[model samples]
Target: MRDAFVRALLREMARDERIVLVTGDLGFGVLRPVKEQFPDRLLNAGIAEQSMVGLAAGLAATGRKVVVYSIGNFPTLRPLEQIRNDCAYHGADVKIVCVGGGFVYGSLGMSHHATEDMAVLRAIPGVTCFTPGDPAETEAVVPAMFQTPGTCYLRLGRGNEPHAHEEPVPDWRFPKAIRLREGRDIALLSAGGILVELKRAAEKLAEAGVSAEVVSFPCLKPLDREAVLSLAGRFTDLITVEEHTILGGFGGAVCEVIAEAGCPCRVHRLGLKDEFSAVVGNQAYLRHLYGIDGEAIAEKAMALINEKRTDAGRNP
Candidate 1:
């Protein structure tokens, strides 16, 4: 997925000399091609995330397209003040990119986890938040980031995630949700890197005689509210899945939309609870422990389907 980000970014940089890539001493190997091809446009900001962001903001203010890169929470959390003040407040065109979201760096511990970044960044006004589901979405987001006019957050997953979309998304300039699989019983909505697992869960739901619709929310902020409202009319249950905490995260974003629409649909928010990981070994193990994995998602979907059936039988 990181490769997809760099590849698209490289293409954009080749055409636009105004673009600059700044890293906080990370992505050396993965971003090698970019560095080799455009040495002057690329910068290593050492280990200072805050300074790197401040510099990016300054560059953007001068009519330059600045893309700041780092891993885990370094890009978002470490320089949050810079993002909120210099970038977002001014609507500067600084694209803050973070790799290894969630527990992708589980062995490295909680310091490397990025479970709360979505909620934190989205709270800041004038910033666009994007969590591309796979290589395709990552590619689409790159060009979109270049075209967008304000502060942006691009949350990237660990490399080698499964492809969720069949082709490049249609909307490169606007923010919206993309529908994957169609069904009537339930709709499984996912944001960020979790779409891969969410797709697998839809398959499990199919085998269990439950039809599940899958929607990928690559754009977190300014969520595809219209899509959610339309889906509410078709499905009884809307289950939101994300790697972040349920509070003010992807799930919370959907809940807000549903609440305002005053729809009769029930939304089940599936994610790492409002707590940190109890134990960690790897991304897979940690996701399983949190019950946000594919199997767990499938199980939760089934429970919702069955419960709705029981209610129908009693009411009828």
Candidate 2:
């Protein structure tokens, strides 16, 4: 996904001279090409996250498309107030790209973990959040961020996630959710960097002779209510999964939609409980400890489907 972002940024730079990239003393190896191609456009703000964000807002005010990049919390959490007041409030055309979302930083410790980024950004008015499912979606959404004129947050994972898109979906815009499978029994909605696991869970459910549809939710805020409602109408049971805490994450957004639309489907929100992640070895271990792995997700989804079927039979 990092490679895809660099590739897309290079392409966007060649096409538009006004496109600028700024990093808060990070991404030296990852953003080298962008620096070489557009030397004046790229700036390393030297560990000053707050100033880096302010710089982007200033550049945007002067008619330059600016993107501020850094690892996890420093970019989003540290300069959060500046991001909210300076960027979102003014509706600045600055794109904030965060790398290593959720527990991807793992042993680097919880301070670097970006579990609260989604909920934080979602609270800021006029900020658009984009959490792509894979490299293909990453390639698609990154370039679109340049064209979009507002404060946008891009949640990028550290490595390969499930290949949600069969091919390079460059023309694809970020939607509230994309239905990858079709079934009347249940619908599973997923968010953030771990979508590959969600798809695997869907396939496992299929092998068990249960029909499950997977809806990839790349965009969290300004959710596509119509698409969610349409899926809810078809599937009698709804489940939402994410790598972040269930509070104010993807599941929270889905709950809001279900309440507003008043969808009659039984809903289940599966994710991290309201708690801080422990100091674990890596992302995989941490996910297992938290019970958010692919196998765990599949198991919970399967159980819900079976329970719903039994209830239906009893009532009939």
Candidate 3:
């Protein structure tokens, strides 16, 4: 995913000379190729996330397409006040690119975990949030951020991430959800790194003769109301998965839609609990510990389906 991010940025840089990449001195392996490709356009701000955001805002004020890149919590949580006041408040044309969202740096502890980033940033007006499912989607979405105006937050994970796209890359559009599978029984909605986990769970459910539809939401801020309603109307059950806490994450956004529209479906949310995670092994192990893995997800989905089935029988 990191390589794809670099490649996508390089492609955008080749086309747009106005694009400038700013970092906080942590993207050594990821930004090396970007620095080599666009020497004059890349800047390392050295451990100052607030200053980096301010600098990016200043650069954007000059009509330059600015991208501030750093680890997730550092970029999104640490400099949040600066981002909210400098970028989102002023409506800067700055793209905030965050790597290692959610539990990507799990072994590094909860301070590095970016569980509340989406919910926090989404609350800000005019700020766009995107979580690419895989390398191909990351490659497509990173470059498209340049075209969007105002503040755009692109959440990326660590290297060697899974590949969700089996075929060619789809069209790039921020604040939109992509339908990966179609089914009437259930709808599995996911965003960020959780999409990969949900995909595996869907595969296992398929093997158990369960037809589950999956929706990969690259964009979470705008919350695709049309898509949510359409899927909710078709499917009898809906499950939302994310790497963030159950509070105010992707599932919360979907629940808002269901309530407002009076849509009928049993929604099950899969994510971290309200408590902060302990210092664990790594991202993968931490996810499993929290019951966010494929097996756990499969179990939850199957249980929900059976519960719905029994309820219907009792009512009938």
Give per-candidate clash totals.
0, 1, 0
The candidate that wins on TM-score is: 1
Arrange candidates, best TM-score first: 1, 3, 2
Native-referenced Cα lDDT, model 2: 0.81
TM-score: model 3 vs. ground truth = 0.96
lDDT of 2 by residue, 1-316 (tens): 7777788889988998988888988886889888777788888889999989988898889988788999978889899998998899989989899888888888888787788888888889999888877788788777767777799999888855457668776566656466677876677887777777777777888888877788777777777788888887887778887778888888888888888888887778877787887666688888777767778788988788778779989998
Q: What is the C-alpha lDDT profile of model 1 across 8-124, one tens digit per residue?
A: 998999999999999999996998998789999989999999889999999998999999999999999989999999999988899999999888898888888899999999999
- Model 3 residue 141 lDDT score: 76
Write out the backbone clash pairs for model 1.
none
Q: Which pairs clash (backbone N, Cα, C closer than 3 Å) in model 3?
A: none
Backbone clash total for model 1 is 0
Model 2 deviation from the true structure expressed as Cα RMSD, one decimal place: 1.5
> How many angstroms is residue 279 displaced in model 3 relative to the true structure, after the best TM-score fit?
4.0
